[model samples]
Target chain A: MRKEVRVAGFGGQGVILAGVILAQASGAIEGREVAQTQSYGPEARGGAARCDVVISDKRILYPKVRQADLLLAMSQPALAKYAVDLDAAKGKVVIDSTLVNELPDGLPPVYRVPATKIAEEEFKNRIVANMVMLGALARVDDVVAYDSLKRAVAENVAPKFRDLNLAALDRGYQAVEGPGLRPAAGANDAPGAPASGGR
Target chain B: MSEDGRKVRIIQGNEASVEGAIAAGCRFFAGYPITPASEIAELMSRRLPPVGGTFLQMEDEIASINAVIGASWGGAKACTASSGPGISLMQEGVGYAAETETPCVVINVMRGGPATGQPTISSQQDIYQARYGGHGDYEIIALVPSSAQEAYDLTIKAFNLAEEFRVPVYLLSDEIVGHTRERVVMGGPIEVRERVAPPKEGYRPYAAGPDGLLPGMPAFNDGYRLLVEGQHHDERGIRAGDDVNKSAALVQRLNDKVRKNIDRITDVERVDLDDAEVAVVCFGSTARPALEAVQSAREKGVKAGALRLRVIWPFPEKVVAELAGRARTLIVPEMNIGKLVLEVRRSAGGRAEVISLPRLGGALHTPEEVEGAIMDAVKGGNAR
Candidate 1:
């Protein structure tokens, strides 16, 4: 299956890092062709940062993802920016519930999780909010294996924050969901069958 | 797939140039960061030190070229790289290298520019700058590589040409050739060219032979006291500006050496021109896409062909003139605002209808765009 995802937020929110992890995990673990590209202007302060990752069994023609299958928004600005362009045919919108007051309705399958509060309050670090979001993404849609993502994170995260980010990922995977939360399409009965280490 | 017993891997053009430079025995590099060209510097920094070579990120482009020249004089095959604006800052130093007869490679990954025009934008605007940007009437050897393979292959050639002729060689690349990712083969053992040593017994650094050129030069402490400078000099490298005869002789020899050896540096790739009525003349980054367009046009029975120029400086005038003689119409497309198209029109001898398709800033004209221009040329347009 083809998966094209865009992770976007403020410049320092680790959204780009999340997209890179997803691309790396998909390529190295699933053995799929992946293209990860980020676009940002010169300014470092409060600028919009977006990274697009496209995973496919076939060759990726263009590096940029025009219509994203999944839009993971970490801030209100990110949601406002990418909500219109999400492919509703196969897209899922995941938002940070704490930062977002009202979720934009009539989108693809919506999952609102308190990503920032979970990372900062439960995991005791705000920087791993993107990792928490990635964990929630793995639980919602088995697009990438959680163990494969953890290996990807361990391989890519800066040495000082590796352990904290792993903990953040675990906390996110175990979070609560409302009644009758349907798993993503094509999810396997075998636990984390898409990912490695049987997690 | 294996061709010539080598594996192909996807790599960017800038990385291909870096690998090419490494394969060409370039052991010393000094450069500053510039968009569309930074990957060359970055890869050099990573790859050079492990192989007992050196790479330095200089403070600016001037310092970068200066350091490379210093490294070249220290008996190392050295190189520096930059984009258009940075290249402009290095012209004075580049002219100094020319006057001193230093052998070094300078890679200019051309970008859109007037003054910081657009940092991320791509253009082939550095053609004039590469040939005539430096002060005076000195001839520079410039190689234009059209693809990732050429970016790797011509770099070794660039070094050999520079050392053999005692001149600075510029690898003129643009954004398309710099950033495009394609298949490149590496790890092939290259046939290296060693520099020719000067004759013993009172060797003169600037002495003109019967052919009006300086012969091979030996390094310092090689049993000869070689005096080199940026000024007009006599046989022994002493400043000879006061004497008009010596200055004229020095300048004439410098020009003749390159002018006499144009055949050694001239290279061109021709495709489907035997029965063509219209031709597309282009160089550097525009050549590949234009050639693709020409092939598509030919399949549609438009009788179009392409001439991809490999040598920008010394301007492959003979081949261009020859190709122009055969075709009824010639269209020249460039990324800059009509820099090389003018040269094509001037050199084609007005035998063919020369058309200029110029695009400014970073945007590259797609193959369909060139196809439209080819169709226009097929419609009996007047010569420019």
Candidate 2:
């Protein structure tokens, strides 16, 4: 199967890092083929930045997202710019509700995850907002499992911030759907572990 | 996999090239960093020391290229990398390295042309610059990688080819391949050739044997008087440019050595070409879309195939010639304005219709865009 995802936001929002984490999880942890490419305007920060990822069980011919199956817009401008061209009815659009408060009318299925606000309030660290957004994405997108995403986050971030990133991911993931994917025990369950300890 | 276990990770093309260089026994790196290619130098700065290699960030591209030559002479497999402008600055050093027969690697992560055109973008504009950049009539090997995995594998091949041929091998990459991150298996059995060590009695640095390869490298501290003369040198590395006969022969020998071994240096990939009516010849990141377009065209009942060039240097003329013989039309899609297409047209030589599908600015030709060209070629739309 083939899946393409585009993540866009302002610079320093870690849009590229989120895409990298997603791709690494799909490719390294899950043993799939993946490619992650990014683009940014001419500015160190506060400019438009985006990363495109393509994941496939087979070799990915066209690396870039020809048309995004999913668009994770972390800002208002990103949503406004991307949502228009999207296949509204078919594609999934997840916006960070904290920054992107007003979504344009005549939209498809839109899931709201206030990643930044949750990062600031619950986690007391705004840096992990991207992780929160990724968590929410894993919940909505059934292509990749949450366990794989968590493992990728651990590999990407430094050791000091690994636990924080993983926690933010878990919160964002459960934020969209309470036990949306597997059972609640699956979160802490090790891979290939026998399904035991049922009440 | 080396002594250690297998290592599979997501790495950028530049970072992968660094890993390949280390695996291929490249111990010296001297470069002036530029956009899209900066990660190579940054990784080298950190990765080289631990592996018993030296990383020197030179003042400029010219100095960086010169330092690479010096390091090679000092018995280190060395390399330097840059974008278009830095490569332009190192043109003189390139000719010098070719004339002196120094075994080194110079990676050109090509960007938009003529100057520092587009640092953060991708362009294959340096096809001519890589093959015929220097003033001298010499042939250097160039490997063009379309993906991060090839970027790693080809870099190791570039160093091996440089050592075996005793010439400056160019890893001609671009921003897309350099910056894009992909799955690259880092540890495996890699083939690395050792530098030839000649007899100490009578060492001729500029002499080629029956295999058209110059004698073993005369490392500076290896107890041999070393003289590396850039301007037309004789067998003993003496200043023989004044000797018209010897100078001309030396220059011709430099060209002949690489040309004679072109068969081994050329690397190309053919997909579904046995019954192809139209062939799409592509390299670099452009090959990705070209391959997709070929398959998409086949779905549309067009007999199309794709030939992806792994090693862009030595022109891969033989394979292209055979492809031209089979395919009725040949389409060349590239980021630049019809550079490699010229070679294709010449090699095709009326055997097949050659078309140029060029994309400018920062964007690459989409698979749909390339398929349109394939359809056009099959319908005899852009036959030239």
Candidate 3:
């Protein structure tokens, strides 16, 4: 089974960076085969940026994710744009409670987290919202160990921002790692274990 | 044979290529996916992470090649793979690596194209592009693998050739070879081709010595102030030529390293061509049919042989010229209208009658067609 996820939001919302951190954790740290692709043109401003990450043991046939198992939409536009591609029966959707005003109809089990509110109220850094989103993705997918994801964030972020990123990740983890959250079906599995290495 | 390692298995051409890159000690990959070549990016994305390496799918083909360049300097063996349209976008990056003498591998899985011609159809139209698409007067090593097994073996060779010469190597394949389903013998850990990392001190990124070619480059963050770009530059990698003589000399030297070392880079599998009166020259998938054609001709006492060009670039002029001396006729069969045939014509030196047998699209030339061409060439009177 492959864990295919997409993180989408405005350029500065750290969607691409969030995807990178998860990819590194699942792919590099966990020793799974991982493919991460991002979409961006010359307009690096407020344009929408989407990153696709596919983690599988067998060789991934296509890097472009046609159907996403997990979708993290940090804004309304992201939710509206990618909601149709989500497999409602088998997928999971996480939205930022602050930016997303209403959940789309016929969506997967939507988990709402006040990512921006947490980043503003506690972390005091807007960029840290991605960290919260990452934590939420971990809670929803459990594709990689929460500790492994934290380690990936610590190793990937610039030295100056590493401390805040790790703190934000832990805070996000603490918020959703409890009993009320939906259990991940393929949870606690190593990323790209040998048995699943090649297709 | 298996203990000697690098055996084969039943694998797709793209998977074979990924395994081959790893066997060649390629630890970094940065690429964007396009059809017919997406499997390469997919495989690298997963494989690089486990070995403490990095796999990045950049924003586009341009960024993909650029990031590969960045990672190469970051002291990682780097590579990228793409189909026709994406490769067209990567020409600038290819020129950049050639100018900087940055060692990396770029795999171009050829598909029918002038502009998005056919993403999934096989064609060898990129032969000239592989040699001339990059912007400057530079030479590159391009290897063409005919089968999945060769795809695996040649990717390793591509990395070795790239590092040994300090230039970008091209594992040039068509959609047929890229997506072909064949039993690839993939066995024990093969001997990987590792780059000769530069010394700690006295490392100039482009210090071409009396031999007049750049040396093995040092990595970035390695204390060496490495200067790199896509300009006609001196040994210091600083843009040094606005005049004809300097630019001409630089181009000559860049061309010389591989042009001079053809025996090493030009891997031609000559099957019974030693004393044949007719020669069939081909590369990639076409060569398989061409080989059968040659065998059938010999059975009919036509004295025909086949030369499969495993390495497409560097042209193998000397070998072709030598083989031309012994053969009375050289039949050049390729998938494209006529690309590599021109190279063969020039190298055959008018000693042998050079004939071109062309095809296009997903229509593969059958062994009977190639046999007919060989027979027709043999029957013709232009035996110079």
lDDT of 1 by residue, B1-384 (tens): 455555554456788889888877889999999887899999999999988899999999999999988888777889999997899999998898888888999999887788787665568888888889998978888988776667888888899888887788999987667765444667656766776787888777777678665677577766778777888888888988889998887777777788887887788878898988889887876775688688789889899988888888888777788888989888888888887878788888898878899987656676788899898887755444
| Per-residue lDDT of model 2, residues A10-39, tens digit only | 998999999999999999889899999999
- The window of 10 residues in a row where model 3 chain B has the poorest summed lDDT is B1-10
Worst 10 residues of 1 chain B by lDDT: B1-10
TM-score for every candidate vs. truth?
Answer: 0.75, 0.94, 0.64
| Candidate 2 error regions (>4 Å) | A177-199, B1-5, B381-384
Who is ahead in TM-score, 1 or 3?
A: 1
Where does model 3 exceed 4 Å of error? Answer: A1-199, B1-7, B187-189, B242-246, B381-384
Q: Can you write out model 2's per-residue Cα lDDT over B60-171, one digit (the tens) per residue?
A: 9999999999999999999999999999999899999998889999998988876757778889999899888889698899999999999999999999999988999999
Error of 3 at B150 (Å): 0.3
lDDT of 3 by residue, B18-38 (tens): 988887788999889987899
Best-to-worst DockQ order: 2, 1, 3
DockQ agreement of candidate 3 with the native complex: 0.02
